[model samples]
Target: MSERITRLEEQVAYLTKTVEDLSDVIARQDRELDQIKRRTQMLMEREAQRDLDEGGSVPLADQKPPHW
Candidate 1:
Protein backbone atom coordinates (compact mmCIF):
# COMPACT_ATOMS: atom_id res chain seq x y z
CA MET A 1 0.00 0.00 0.00
CA SER A 2 0.98 3.66 -0.31
CA GLU A 3 1.44 4.00 3.47
CA ARG A 4 3.81 1.05 3.59
CA ILE A 5 5.97 2.53 0.86
CA THR A 6 6.10 5.84 2.72
CA ARG A 7 7.20 4.10 5.92
CA LEU A 8 9.97 2.24 4.10
CA GLU A 9 11.15 5.43 2.46
CA GLU A 10 11.40 7.17 5.84
CA GLN A 11 13.41 4.32 7.27
CA VAL A 12 15.81 4.42 4.33
CA ALA A 13 16.32 8.15 4.79
CA TYR A 14 17.13 7.77 8.49
CA LEU A 15 19.55 4.94 7.75
CA THR A 16 21.31 7.00 5.10
CA LYS A 17 21.81 9.86 7.56
CA THR A 18 23.16 7.51 10.22
CA VAL A 19 25.65 6.01 7.79
CA GLU A 20 26.91 9.43 6.81
CA ASP A 21 27.36 10.43 10.46
CA LEU A 22 29.27 7.26 11.27
CA SER A 23 31.49 7.73 8.24
CA ASP A 24 32.45 11.21 9.49
CA VAL A 25 33.24 9.87 12.96
CA ILE A 26 35.49 7.16 11.50
CA ALA A 27 37.37 9.69 9.38
CA ARG A 28 38.10 11.88 12.37
CA GLN A 29 39.29 8.94 14.42
CA ASP A 30 41.62 7.91 11.61
CA ARG A 31 43.24 11.31 11.65
CA GLU A 32 43.63 11.25 15.44
CA LEU A 33 45.19 7.79 15.34
CA ASP A 34 47.76 8.94 12.81
CA GLN A 35 48.74 11.85 15.02
CA ILE A 36 49.04 9.62 18.08
CA LYS A 37 51.26 7.19 16.18
CA ARG A 38 53.60 9.93 15.09
CA ARG A 39 53.85 11.36 18.60
CA THR A 40 54.62 7.92 20.05
CA GLN A 41 57.39 7.36 17.51
CA MET A 42 58.95 10.72 18.29
CA LEU A 43 58.82 10.10 22.02
CA MET A 44 60.45 6.70 21.60
CA GLU A 45 63.25 8.16 19.54
CA ARG A 46 63.87 10.90 22.05
CA GLU A 47 64.00 8.43 24.94
CA ALA A 48 66.46 6.22 23.09
CA GLN A 49 68.69 9.17 22.36
CA ARG A 50 68.56 10.21 26.00
CA ASP A 51 69.56 6.74 27.12
CA LEU A 52 72.54 6.86 24.82
CA ASP A 53 73.49 10.26 26.19
CA GLU A 54 73.26 9.11 29.80
CA GLY A 55 75.17 5.86 29.32
CA GLY A 56 74.91 2.63 27.41
CA SER A 57 74.76 0.60 30.63
CA VAL A 58 72.14 -2.10 31.00
CA PRO A 59 68.83 -1.06 32.43
CA LEU A 60 67.66 -2.53 35.73
CA ALA A 61 65.10 -4.62 33.91
CA ASP A 62 67.86 -6.35 31.96
CA GLN A 63 70.03 -7.11 35.02
CA LYS A 64 70.36 -10.71 36.25
CA PRO A 65 68.55 -11.82 39.40
CA PRO A 66 70.21 -10.54 42.57
CA HIS A 67 70.38 -14.08 44.02
CA TRP A 68 72.68 -15.15 41.18
Candidate 2:
Protein backbone atom coordinates (compact mmCIF):
# COMPACT_ATOMS: atom_id res chain seq x y z
CA MET A 1 0.00 0.00 0.00
CA SER A 2 2.88 2.40 0.73
CA GLU A 3 4.45 1.62 -2.66
CA ARG A 4 1.21 2.36 -4.42
CA ILE A 5 0.90 5.65 -2.55
CA THR A 6 4.50 6.58 -3.42
CA ARG A 7 3.87 5.88 -7.08
CA LEU A 8 0.79 8.04 -7.07
CA GLU A 9 2.66 10.90 -5.44
CA GLU A 10 5.42 10.68 -8.04
CA GLN A 11 2.92 10.65 -10.87
CA VAL A 12 1.08 13.66 -9.45
CA ALA A 13 4.32 15.60 -9.11
CA TYR A 14 5.26 14.89 -12.71
CA LEU A 15 1.85 15.93 -13.98
CA THR A 16 1.97 19.13 -11.95
CA LYS A 17 5.32 20.05 -13.47
CA THR A 18 4.11 19.35 -16.98
CA VAL A 19 1.04 21.50 -16.49
CA GLU A 20 3.15 24.43 -15.25
CA ASP A 21 5.53 24.14 -18.20
CA LEU A 22 2.68 24.09 -20.68
CA SER A 23 1.10 27.12 -18.98
CA ASP A 24 4.31 29.07 -19.40
CA VAL A 25 4.46 28.16 -23.08
CA ILE A 26 0.88 29.28 -23.63
CA ALA A 27 1.53 32.67 -21.98
CA ARG A 28 4.59 33.26 -24.16
CA GLN A 29 2.65 32.42 -27.30
CA ASP A 30 -0.13 34.81 -26.30
CA ARG A 31 2.39 37.65 -26.06
CA GLU A 32 3.88 36.81 -29.44
CA LEU A 33 0.46 36.63 -31.09
CA ASP A 34 -0.43 40.06 -29.69
CA GLN A 35 2.76 41.51 -31.16
CA ILE A 36 2.00 40.02 -34.55
CA LYS A 37 -1.54 41.40 -34.48
CA ARG A 38 -0.28 44.92 -33.74
CA ARG A 39 2.31 44.79 -36.51
CA THR A 40 -0.22 43.58 -39.08
CA GLN A 41 -2.67 46.32 -38.08
CA MET A 42 0.03 48.97 -38.49
CA LEU A 43 1.01 47.67 -41.93
CA MET A 44 -2.61 47.67 -43.09
CA GLU A 45 -3.09 51.28 -41.95
CA ARG A 46 0.08 52.35 -43.76
CA GLU A 47 -1.06 50.63 -46.96
CA ALA A 48 -4.39 52.40 -46.80
CA GLN A 49 -2.68 55.80 -46.37
CA ARG A 50 -0.36 55.07 -49.29
CA ASP A 51 -3.29 54.15 -51.50
CA LEU A 52 -5.03 57.37 -50.60
CA ASP A 53 -1.91 59.34 -51.44
CA GLU A 54 -1.65 57.64 -54.82
CA GLY A 55 -5.24 57.91 -55.89
CA GLY A 56 -6.03 56.86 -59.50
CA SER A 57 -2.44 55.62 -59.97
CA VAL A 58 -2.38 51.96 -58.96
CA PRO A 59 1.08 50.54 -58.63
CA LEU A 60 1.99 47.39 -60.54
CA ALA A 61 1.69 45.34 -57.39
CA ASP A 62 -1.88 46.61 -56.89
CA GLN A 63 -2.95 45.20 -60.23
CA LYS A 64 -5.05 42.09 -60.64
CA PRO A 65 -3.54 38.75 -61.60
CA PRO A 66 -3.50 37.66 -65.22
CA HIS A 67 -6.12 35.05 -64.46
CA TRP A 68 -8.64 37.73 -63.52
Which candidate achieves the best TM-score against the true structure?
A: 1
- lDDT by residue (tens digit), candidate 2, 2-67: 999999999999999999999999999999999999999899768877987978455567679899
TM for candidate 2 is 0.79
Residues 1-68, candidate 1, lDDT per residue (tens digit)? 99999999999999999999999999999999999999998997777768878987655655698899
CA error at residue 43 for candidate 1, angstroms: 0.3
Q: Which stretches of candidate 2 lie over 4 Å from their true place?
A: 56-68
lDDT at 31 for candidate 2?
Answer: 100
